[model samples]
Target: MAELHEQLQQLWSTANKSFRNVAAYGKRNGVKLSPSTVKGWLGGVVPDSTTALTALVEYLETAAERESGWQRLPGGEWAALYRAAHEAKVKARQKTSAPATTPQRASSAPTLQNSTSPAQPGDIEKARRILKAFPLDASWFTSFEHQASFHRIHDSVQDPLYDGQNVLARNYKVRFLDPDLQRQSEKFHDTVNAFLHSLDHMDADGKSGYSQIPTEWRRSFRDQYESLLRKLSGQRDELMTEYGALINLFNERGIPLLPNGS
Candidate 1:
């Protein structure tokens, strides 16, 4: 039992780190996990009796190759250890017996019916456009292991920026491309249109014909438009990068569709 406890302790430490890393990796893959909840797993303070030990074992097994010296644990022995631990903690077991013999009766099993509506012809195109515009690869997102680390980092730093809320927002932005980007782009266009309309209404002398505009106004407009252009350019670049990665992932996995409109 002492040996078991020692092994459990080591396993706990390994699992704590491994689970977080897995969680972080999943986040990078667009999944999000709560930092506080992840911390509980790492701290060995998980409250669920049925899951605590199982979670530790499962995480350790998943991360065994990544963790040093984890390969030394015997598989059968590990299973035995968990079983023994569970038996020691849970005392009562309810026995279930087969039904007694009785006269045969015909019965029918209920069938489930689908209620979902069929997709429209344009749905696929819309989905493709959305995917192309919003890619998932971003530094803010963490994998499973990184998720655990994120929790630790958050706890130590107490930075609200790394909290799950931001992670979730980033996720939603990445996963649903059209609404977020299109909305922003539409707002930008509206602002630019309004500015141009204002310029159109300027007094004849103030509106100096395009070729006769004062040098100062030209420079100011250039600077303002340049800044807006840069912002849009940066957003486009990020979208491309994410889309490219997503395309590669799908291609490698034998997906038939391309991420881009092509």
Candidate 2:
């Protein structure tokens, strides 16, 4: 069966129009839509809200009647597919984040405890939960793929027709910031901020940011972008390691540090 994204792509193909055109059609029908939202769906990011999904389904159903006369998937069927895809993605993440089981020794040997006391029974699972609940990924580079997609889409469509300054029109990078990373906190944030400050210092030939780098500088953009991502990713790894250690410390003491009833 087709996943939500695949079904959306099929609808787009059947519509036979640019995303801008489809969005315009949506506007005509009193449905607010943006090309980037469609692009996000195509990139496997589920629709942000049920209202957006319903508007998209309506737009696709009749967006290309004159050109291809192709009717899109019915609303009920599309909703079912979306729910299945969402559930599948959730299950996959849960499976990935689950803690590994430690093998048991056949011999019941008395182990001498050190002053540092090794992790207790549920510590591994608690650490896993903490890592799973952390807002940022273990690596910033992994999230960079999604950011790169946003930039590419912004570059393609942010012209005279689209108001690039409009927040709704512009597709910004997705940032998964942990609450503990805030300046108010007394931990892992400093290193993260250092990397972020490096990004702030970068000059894209007077352009607004990496996405708007001049055409001539495009050749070096990938290298520059990936280099920064690598540095940030290293910092992210360190942050995750430190966060896991902190979680373990709390877990050992029976302190509830999981994210607000997580």
Candidate 3:
């Protein structure tokens, strides 16, 4: 079976760009992927989070060498590969951690390591630790990796973010977490839209409207651009607080998706 890192290396080799270029592509596409993260993926680290894997795969699709006729695998095939690789890594970890006892004792060992349970405050703390393993910044609202970090914590504690009636939000496309998550996500997309609109408008307008527009009218454009450029410390703090609320709410409601792991 091909490991994910090995497959990533093969894909990287087939692409025309270097790791830094790939990282830059990720940033443009709203993922906070770094060159070091790409290097780590090539160095045998199983991308426990799918966001990084998706970023790399999508990057390769855009960066493929057309002259050489290179093409990435189909989306379905990529999904299969990711599932296989993740399963293989999980199995390997389980095998290595297995006790050296007799067959009977080994069989008696618990198999519910991933069982669901309400996320305790301790689980929240542990999730915070896991979040530390990934990069974070003011741009986290646009970074799917930041969203994935919360999923990791939720998965580890066996908490499902979905409401019972709405399973579609948990899918690859929407990825709905907290209501705040959705709100912030929409806000980020709006900001991106505004930036694009301003870019196109400025390019078309040029100096034609330079002296015609009032001071506030010109500053309105500047304000929109500045909003896009300004630091998002408030948003970041809000997200952090929302994460904590998710855990606390689930814990109080006693509605975890599964029993606590042994």
lDDT of 2 by residue, 1-262 (tens): 7888777778778777775565566667765455545655665655545677787777676765655887655548887987886776566546534544446778897343333554454444433443343423322324443452222213322221122112111121211122222111224333433433333222222133132222433466777665555665565466446555555555554545544225
Superior candidate under TM-score, 2 versus 3: 2
TM-score of each: 0.24, 0.41, 0.37
TM-score of 2: 0.41
Evaluated at residue 6, the lDDT of candidate 3 is 68
If candidate 3 were superposed on the true structure by all CA atoms, what would the RMSD be? 15.7
Candidate 3 per-residue lDDT, tens place, 132-181, comes to 32113312323423442121111111111111101211111332233333
Task: Choose the strongest candidate by lDDT.
Answer: 2
Tell me how far the alpha carbon of residue 90 in candidate 1 is from the true structure, in angstroms, after superposition.
3.1
TM-score (C-alpha, index-matched) for candidate 1: 0.24
Worst 10 residues of 1 by lDDT: 149-158
Q: Give lDDT for model 2.
A: 0.47
In model 2, how large is the Cα lDDT of residue 216?
39
Query: Candidate 1 on 15-105: residue-level lDDT in tens?
Result: 5453345444444554333333343333322223434344445556566547655664655675565566445423311111122234454
Please identify model 3 stretches exceeding 4 Å from their true place: 102-262
